[model samples]
Target chain A: MSVTKKDVNYVADLARLKLSEEETESLANDMNQILDYMTTLEELDTSDVEPLEHVIDLEYRLRDDKAKEPLSHEDALKNAPDADTDYFRVPRVIE
Target chain B: MSSSVNDNYEAVIGLEVHAQLLTESKAFAPVSTEFGGSPNTQVSPLCLGHPGTLPVLNENLVRYIIKMGLATNCDIARKSIFARKNYFYPDLPKGYQISQYDTPICHDGHIDITTDGVDKKIGITRIHMEEDAGKSIHDQDPFNTLIDLNRAGVPLIEIVSEPDIRSAKEAYEYLKRIKQIVQYLEICDGNMEEGSLRCDANVSVRPKGREEFGTRTELKNMNSFRNVERAIDFEIERQIELIESGGKVVQQTLLWDANKMETRMMRSKEEAHDYRYFPEPDIPPVVVTDEMLEDIKEELPEMPDVRKQRFIDEFDMSDDDAQTLTEDRYLADFYEEVLLHAGNPKAVSNLILTEVLRTLNDRSIGIKEFPISEERLAGLVQLREDDKINSSAMTEIYNAMLEEEKTAEELAKEMNLVQVSDTDFLEPIVDEVIEQHPDEVERYRNGKKGLIGFFIGQVMQRSQGKANPEMVREMISDRLEQE
Candidate 1:
């Protein structure tokens, strides 16, 4: 129910984020407060109510399995941080 | 590192198969799901995990998984929710993959497999739909891993099995059954070499009568069915040796190096899969109604098991023969279609097993791609069945029909491969063979009955392979027995 410093660091690591000591502390505090605030809703005993997966009540939206035009290789890689002619280059991934 | 297989210990293996759905579009995007395209050319913004992009479900993805579930006898979930599994990898751009965690779409299914002639039912833990990650090419580049996003959002169904597989061969059979069912449904192409279908194994070892399971290791990067079997065999051996040497097995992920035939630790990758999964908020729950089940059931083709059993029962063929004939839907259909025209199940099956399958393997093509059709092949089998041509003549006619557009009989006549079954046509050849081989005939008359094979061979050679060996045997016996 509470966010610890190690939890914040672990989550930051998973998200590939590097946080300073100050940012980590503040983020932990903020997340704990948010969790504490959200915990109040749990006290209402809404166990009888149905759990909704999404906020919107619309029907399940599905599309036909038809291919549409995709972005060209150039347009697709235009925003990559580092890319070669055909691939997005990244640090070596050890298998 | 094994001192032979430890019979005191048994292996426990469970497979997780990821089958890429054969849909035209990506799972959550409308971009093409075509394989072998130029790198990243078939990707869309949503597939690339662009900001402010939302994913819509593909209708066919759900339907295909449902068909597989039904084929595997899974209890179709009335309602299923998608979940986000948080992780970090170069191939996964979303940082979190949209998967099914708590609520899978299909569950409690079972697949029956035969390992060493022992029929066993491997329980299905669950089958869930998810999207595929992009390709990561590590060996292609010198320093960095090259990534292609074309396969990022392609549809996939992950089939998880219960830990019922107790041997490497059982794992092989279980994987084969899964592949057969998916291919039979026409949902997945089941091509493992090109990454259309992939399997991961969790292997462990336990004492023969132990009630509890030992620590398990997850194996990845096995690209072929044979590799899957070998990797599991290696893992089982390694784990058993580790325990026998007073060493404890560690629960971690291992990568199977097929070249070296060993499993190595995938260090630092183990920490990346804590996978804090939660219900996906973007896509709503997919509800499967009764009507949907009925419609999909009607659309489901005859599964491999049913068709295989029918081949055994109705066609009166052996289990191995029926199995070979029904290995694929198209192959089985070709068998029946040929039978419909040829009217003899046994001969048609024999031709298919030997001649047809050899052609399929030799050309590395499927039944659909092979030059001969069912009707044409049936004509060939009918010739052999009606005794117009012998088996070798049938083979010759079949090979000639591959290049020519003529029927089997036409090609048989053109190549002088038709069988000579007439008593008048074959009597002289038989008589000539006996007269020429008088010394052998004397031995044959003195009760060396096996020399009849030599006599038949000579007669066949003299007639240029047109003499029916069975008929020649009868005619030669009648003349040789004149006492």
Candidate 2:
């Protein structure tokens, strides 16, 4: 199976990825290749195979529910491109 | 007014709670789940849904969910499956969300939430594991938005409940009970403001005694417990009005505008088939052994409900008081420590629940951050119990304890809060008060019984608040009778 040009654009639109034409074609090819590889599982013919939820069936490990200090305003806004004195700055949100 | 309240319409409420598991690592990858981190810094290749990247389950998350299942008395499935829920969003780097579909790890549970002298069981249909989507900030602009992947791939357990709730108050109690359970299990932080735990309510109204269900509206983005209750109440009323006015209640998803205090339609509700789900083939199926289950079961702590009941039976505290004390593990532990120190659970519960809790609430403080140690609180209760300090003096010492670091005993001693319990010590002061207040004494002698309290106050004023009221009252009454 292979991804058509339409399939490439559809996935890019769904994921909101601003993909160039070349990038789209390349990703489509790569995903098709991966999907092709996954087709090997069909040969196993294990219809009754059960899926696993957890690797280990352990019960409870709990942390002390104590309140701790949160990050400072500056630290919290470290990654934001724009920040105000106490908040991360953004444009007007409402009309 | 909601038609449910006016007419014979019964509101059916179900809650979908998404609790971010308190794991140090992300759900599908080993990235740190710490809050307020740099955006996209913690995202691994799998979380970003990069090509050729596969998700590996975080072992700690599974253990946490199992612990919750056991605490809630649910059946833990020996097998379960992870399916990809296909959706498109900028923050969801993975075009589809990797979540549990049909088979969940836990199923068929019930939580009994008691409120207003009524016990009601809210049925939990399933608790399934899933990865959280990153946050979308629409404040950037009306037409533009920014994405923060810091919360992406955080492990979460979605506890979906049956529509067993009847009112907004019942919904609040159910959510509160769930928060306590998760917090007690040490699985989730249960902080609604931080988005660690969130509540989504599916509300509908049916004519009373009708077997058919009403169309439901989903309410989301509740930042606090009060908002959850308020939004549901408003939506229920809105739907009831629409239905009563000969309009059909359309099923849709709504975002709660906390500032506006109204629910705005976000999108039409999607059915199960809308998100095309298929088993994720990248990850292999997980299998567990009986030995592992037994080992995990052994590590379970005594749950909140069991501990609350035990407090009532063991400490002989009233059910209402016991429930309040045992609601939080830290407060419960503090109360237990006070009992250990004072050897009087009854007095300890009263002081902690009534005095300590009231003070904490008044200051908007949490018990985990309470400054006074349990041993010190026990000292205050002991002083009052032993008549070392009168009740009036106890409040003064309590304040001093907060402002300073002295033990309750030391402060009571230093501030002269020791009660003058001896009538011999008090009789002299009482005589002085009577001699000074001759007019009042005459009025009391002329059959004014209420003036006895005034004479007692005079004695207390001469001795400060340290004089025991009972002893001073007896001395003054005897002296007046003799006169």
Candidate 3:
């Protein structure tokens, strides 16, 4: 159940983060400690317990399929960090 | 190009199809789901993945997926949950797509496809409901990819097939059937070029007798049904050639370069589907009740296969004609509606198969958009059946009817295209034809019976295509014998 340096590095890479060596080492140690603390709950045997899917027991609330007007194109792109007038722009991506 | 490698090996194929549901609203948001809005005009806070916004499930989305599941003979799960498949792309503004992971809404269905007169059943692995990502236009911008969130949160159903398809042709048949079923259900538009429907293929090859499979590559970006077949065929040949030349087939994603007619390697992502799927906490588990299933089943339109068989049995339609007529639900509905007005299924079928279909092709319109009403088309068919118009005359009247907005009878007379069935009228034309072509008449009486056609042609031409050839034939024979 130990979080290894490789695991931290892989996850950080997926998140597009470039952590320094010290930060990576610290994240690995912190994740390991958290896993170690959570392992204490495993000592209690609950083989017959049903897995809980949700904290609340309520079913999903559904809305009728009627459509409402969406935000204006201008408003939709207002908060975009990088955008042209009509589009939210990002670094060039290929398939 | 050679058959040697192909003969020694066989390819296995499975298709994953994504069909955008035609719900009025987005899958989880209450915003419009219309296609091709001025970029981002269809986006809401939830669609844009703004903080503090939550999604409410759309009722029609569930109903439509259930209709599709029933149409495809899939078992609808009593309880289905949405899972978040985490990924990072500009198109995926949420950084995760809400999809069904472990328990798909429908499973264990089978679609029967016929290829070259041989029927094979391809097993459906699963059909799950999901939300679509935004549109990323890479070619439209030089420095940055443009994103249109209008497509984000649009409802989609992913239909995955078992690795049961044997060849590219079978895959094609299977895809055609999938398209037909979805279109029939009216759950989706089933348009591939417009991206309402999309497909990807998983391809692998093995020796004919080998039970195990080779490494498979995934193919994406095929925009049409033809491209799907061609891509699979090209991938199969490429894999076989690689193995033939002592190269190993690697499992990776390739893009179908339709212009080049070859598959090229897609730039590999940081990780292959490193999507860590988890249960979506926002949407509570959905429970499909028995009453819901019953309602969906009752409302499910008759699927293409069943309707096709019924057409064959009920109307005495040939298999090819039946297949063509039932290819689209609207077209089949138009045929049946015409039959309500016209007697003689064979005649109506012929008219639809030839003239009506030609108009549809030439105009590039669907039956729903066809200009001629069922009543008018039925009237045209009846005229031919009643020997009032020859086939060519019927065609002329049909073509003229396209723009005039007049009934078939009104246009028939206006265009002088009706057959002159009266013996009294045709006899004069027959007399003129016989008197002018005495050599042909003499030859006809001397047992050159085939010259009757020449005489009939002359009479029709003289009458300006108005004389009934059958009546003219009978009178000419009697006159020739008597004279």
Candidate 4:
């Protein structure tokens, strides 16, 4: 369950994080130490221990299922980084 | 026609729904879950997955999830734990999402869904709590995308159902039922367009009598119920054709292309071992006490299914009518409140489900925002019952009621909605109309029984439609018999 420099580099690329080689190596050590500490739970016998799922047990709080008014086109596109007359358009999203 | 070949094929369908809980707060932090706020304004240190921050449980979220479990008849676990579903995505600032893996909150439940007059039970495998990741804006450039953390850390309950569905219609009905139940329970707003509720379907095919499962492809990005079923159907047929041609159906994740009405592969599927799931240590194990469970159970409200059954038995309403009213909780509650005042459950159900619902849908308005209150709606129904106005005139009154703040009685008085009661005063108008239309009156006297309605229409028209329809009919029939 330990993280290595290779693991750090792999995750960085997957998440599109542009990290320097030295930074990747440093993070690998830090993550590995954290993982090592977390493994302490594995040493405790949890075979019979039930996993806790929710903080409390309650059932069925329902709101009426009706469609509320949707945002107007102008209000919806108000915060778009780039916009045209109507649609929120950025640079070429797809080729 | 290959009828026998069609009989040999079976459709296996399963649903994976991601329901964003309608809690006031975020999943693991105290940040508000309000929709449409400033970007990243709701983010807390823990939500951003900062190094020093840890997640504290939001009690309301747990109550919400448990409520869902109860509605679905799920087994509520006394304890549950969070695990890291290891995945690397830009929007997921934590690198790995904290979710329930092996030990889900509830499991082994079933729900009954009706499609085309047939009822079937769909098995629920698990309902687990998970924190959602943010959105990736891939529209930035040809090779890159930006990330929005506003959606990140939103709480979600993923309800995974067993592949018991057979046809596209059945899948649609099952999805609708799930949406209804969750919305009725107030756990989720059930807004597909807003990404508050989302569904992913797994489709596969097998030869008749085959016990082994066929290779399944997962479909995503279905914003509507129709799209969910259509995407599954198209994918199933595609797999069937491919398999019949001796090609293997690849196991992968595919995104639904709404424009092309097809599914394209996003990535090859990965096994559980690939991401390396493990217990999340940053958060402690969640514990559920008996007292908390009891409090939640006691607070559970009436679900739609039960309420529908009650409406049918108590109100003597038709199944179709009851189903329509109870499908939306607000409409059902509105009907109930009006019945409490009007004392005519059947009539209230009909007017609300048919006339009121039609008006609401036509205007694209919500029941909550309807200017007509329950008391006023009941008053309208009562007026009709008391012979104060005819059904035709009731529509105008109802419409006017929406724009007018006055009560139904007040509006009736203001608009002169009272029916004509004096037969002596009506006798002259009826006689004048009969004398003026001698040909129609002669036709009616010569056994043109249907013409009686025409004569009554003339009287009502002369009275400006405020005449009591029953009294007008009585007067017209009596005068016709004499002629």
Candidate 5:
């Protein structure tokens, strides 16, 4: 499949990115090149090989179901761009 | 339009339910997963997506999911991987949710639900584990949307159902069964109102006998079971109307306005997220051992269907009573405990169905907070069985028991509500009533047979409601016949 400018713009919209015309053109070209390079893997013949989900073969590391101390309210909102006494405030978000 | 015209199409529905696991801590972080704490007080650095923080899986989360899988007859995957679903939302601290994409933990499960006296099996496509985002309260602030990260990093399991539901009623049954199973497994509280359990439905409609499905719309924001059914019904009608008007059904994401009872489009299919999924590098794939599966299987409680069948076979209960009793786990247990003491299943079931449930509703308390002990309730039932109290006296004693710590017998004695079956004690009252109500007696002799109720009422009043009604009726009938 070929990457098109419309597809790039649509993706950018979903990602909440404001892309200019020049940037959209360059990103579309970059995506096409990446797709072309990925097609090289289609030539490899490994019909019997199982698809890999993770690179490292490791078992899950699990912790007990215990609660630890969480951050205080003051520390939790320390880095908020905007906040009230307890909540992290953002510009009104409506669907 | 006529009913026949609306019946020309069939609606196809499938539901996706997200159940928040009742684990003590968040999915990956050590922050508390308790609900309704102060805002942001339950967040850890990892939950906030601070740099240099790594996630570790909670052991109970996996066990809880496996328990659900076994209960629902799911094929548990031996190896499951977590993937990062890239998205941007204010509630998502990490800007991407750690979820399962291709390798879900459970798959190929089927749950049987009975709707309209017909049992149908809804196929489960998959159950994947994921982390919940924080809450955004838009109504709390006038100018801003307030975010609470306490719910972030909470563990959740998304159960995806195959498109097998044929109507809104069937969808309702499917959701109820799912909630019952989760509550029985003790993994989720199954409170849709509290947001612990959430459902989103995909709905489509097609001409009758058509095989190819129409474009489907995804519906969200239904907070209750009734709303789920209502929304599906409204959407089906809307789609059918759209199709009949020469307009095609567009694939979109719609939010159900519960008050308005209509669905409004949130976004179309083109605006759907790609969710560029990749394996989460911070956590490793979960490997289920045979021993672990066996242990979880051993821990599985008796499911609702099996308990319902057992109640029918063992207790000789009616199908409806068994179903009503087994709908809630605690209620079923209470019924069983009463059975152990009362030894009469039908009677016990009747009492619970009427008096116990009425009291519960009147006081607005759950069965757990009910004041009457199971043993005391059984004792009351036993008293009625032994003819120590009549039905009215039984009700009075029950209401009294709710107020104070007194036995049924003690309450019966204190309130002078015991049944007086002895002939000598009731004969005088019967004779006096017969002598005093001479006109009624003559009318009774003239075959006004219904006056027996009035005579019984007088005798009961004179005896302070302690007269055994059956005995009084027999004695009074015998004396009147002597004339």
Candidate 6:
């Protein structure tokens, strides 16, 4: 399971990251190493083992349907990079 | 042009509908899930993806999904797991959506719909719970997109249907049935324009005899049921045209432009999201116990199909009328309530189908907002049944009732719209009509039996529309015939 330069670029595009050619090459190598390390699990022959989804065995810790108070508009947008009135402003995205 | 184009090809369509649940709070946060709040005011630390906050599943969310599952006859999974679908967008504050990936809560359900009087079953592939993303308003500003996190943590259930729909009309029927079921269960409001209920269709076309499936494209941006049908039709035609012109159908995502009535490419498969899903660690797995299933099943309201059948059998309604009446839960309830008072199902159904529905459409209000009470409507129908009012008089009284705050009987009396069936009172008016229209009376005696209608009309007009038309007819005929 080796990661190629094209795979790295495709993933980077999906993540909306801007990477240079040099960085792309270096990232490809780094991802391939991680993939190779993950391949070690395939060597284990545990055909009967059930796949684990979570570390804990807990189930159904739920809250009631009643609503609680939420943040004020100012508090919610306090940490935003840019805000206008009551909205967080970002670069225009065409549909 | 369409016949030749569609003759050799057949369309295959499947729809994915996202219905936002009417839960009081966010799926995992305590923040209010109500729509139309000021921007960002509905946000909580858990919904905003603050570092230290953890998510707690909402009990009502689970119950709502189970209700849907039972309504659609889906097999509720004994154990279901929530997974984090990793994606990045400004509106997705967590950089991932908590959704059901491999282990959906419900599966293998089938919904029956009728198209052209033929029943067809569309298979439900799966129904999974998820959280919604926030709104991004692009047209609000010239250079910036505004984000509102009010909807970010709202609960949703995505219903995926099998590719069993054969045409645009079938797809339309199937979507309507889905909406009806959700609305019946009271889990979702089923308002497409408000974004509470949204749909995306997967459409493809193939030669009529081909057994293998053709390449398909996913269509989005259709906000209404009509748009969904139109978009599927347009996509099917576009695919067939491309194939006939020696071009291959490419799988992609397209947006339906309702104004232009065409679908434009949004993105191709290469740009599709590879949502790397992993089990959600913050929230635990949901287990449906036998008791829980029983409770949900008992609480499930009668679905649309069953109610439609009962209407046909019980009320002796036609299939079409029954279908229309049961399309909305509230409308069906209103029909039953009127039936209790009127004691005549067919008459009530007809009045509701024609008069009540017309009024509702004119005012753009639902049955919930209709001004006339069930008892009042039933009284109006009863008046007509009892020969107390003619059809025209009934219509007049009904229209007047809409404007006045009075019962049907009160309105009938105030407007002088009741039929005067008393022979003693109508005989004088009938004799006067006969005496004045001697030419018509002579014609009536000469076997021009249709002139009886003219005499009746004159008597009714003289009585200001209060004369019983049938009694007037009998008297006019007898008086003219007497030597």
Write one digit per residue (lDDT tens) for candidate 1, span B1-483: 534558788888999999999999999999998889999899888878888999999999999999999888899998899999887788898888888998899999998999888999999999999999999999988899999998898999999999999988998898888888888898988888888889999999998899899999999999999999999999998888888889999998999999999999876553646788888999999988898889999998887878889988998889999888788777887888887899988888888888888988999888889898778888998898889888788888989878887899888888898888888888878778777888987898899998878888888888999988888888888888884
lDDT of 4 by residue, A19-79 (tens): 9989998998999888888788779988997555444544423222222232344554455
Give per-residue CA lDDT, model 6, range B221-283, as digits (tens). 999999999999899889998999899998888999999999998755545678978899887
The clash number for model 3 is 0
lDDT of 4 by residue, B332-415 (tens): 888889988898887787788778888898897768777789998999999988888888878888989888887777877788
Clashing pairs in 2: A52-B286, A59-B296
Error of 1 at A75 (Å): 2.2
Clashing pairs for model 3 are none
TM-score of each: 0.91, 0.80, 0.95, 0.83, 0.91, 0.92
Cα lDDT for residue B107, candidate 4:
88
Task: Show model 6 residue runs off by greater than 4 Å.
Answer: A2-45, B267-271, B362-365, B422-424, B481-483
Q: Is candidate 4 or candidate 6 better by DockQ?
A: 6
In candidate 5, what are the lDDT values of residues B195-304, reduced to their tens digit? 89999999999889999999999999999999999999999999988888899998888999988889998855544568899999888889999999999999999999
Residue-level lDDT of model 3, residues B1-483, one tens digit each, is: 689869999899989999999999999998999876788899899999999999899999889888877877789898888999988988888899999999898999988889999998899889999999998898988888999888999999999999999898998899889889988988888889998999999999998999998999999999999999999999999999999999999999999999999999988775767887888988888899998889888997887878999999999999989999999998999999999999889999888898889888998777888998999889888888888888789888888888888888888788887888788788777777777887887788898999878887888888899877777877877888787
Candidate 5 regions with alpha-carbon error over 4 angstroms: A1-42, B267-270, B360-366, B369-371, B401-414, B421-424, B439-452, B477-483
Show where candidate 4 strays beyond 4 Å.
Answer: A1-95, B1-4, B138-144, B267-273, B364-366, B369-371, B403-406, B410-416
Which candidate, 2 or 4, would have the higher DockQ against the true structure?
2
Could you tell which candidate, 4 or 5, scores higher by DockQ? Answer: 5
Compute the lDDT of residue B227 as modeled in candidate 6: 96
Q: RMSD, each candidate, Å?
A: 2.9, 6.0, 2.1, 6.6, 3.0, 2.8
True contacts kept of each: 0.91, 0.04, 0.87, 0.03, 0.88, 0.86
Model 4 deviation from the true structure expressed as Cα RMSD, one decimal place? 6.6
TM-score of chain B of each: 0.89, 0.89, 0.95, 0.93, 0.93, 0.94
DockQ of each: 0.84, 0.10, 0.81, 0.09, 0.73, 0.73
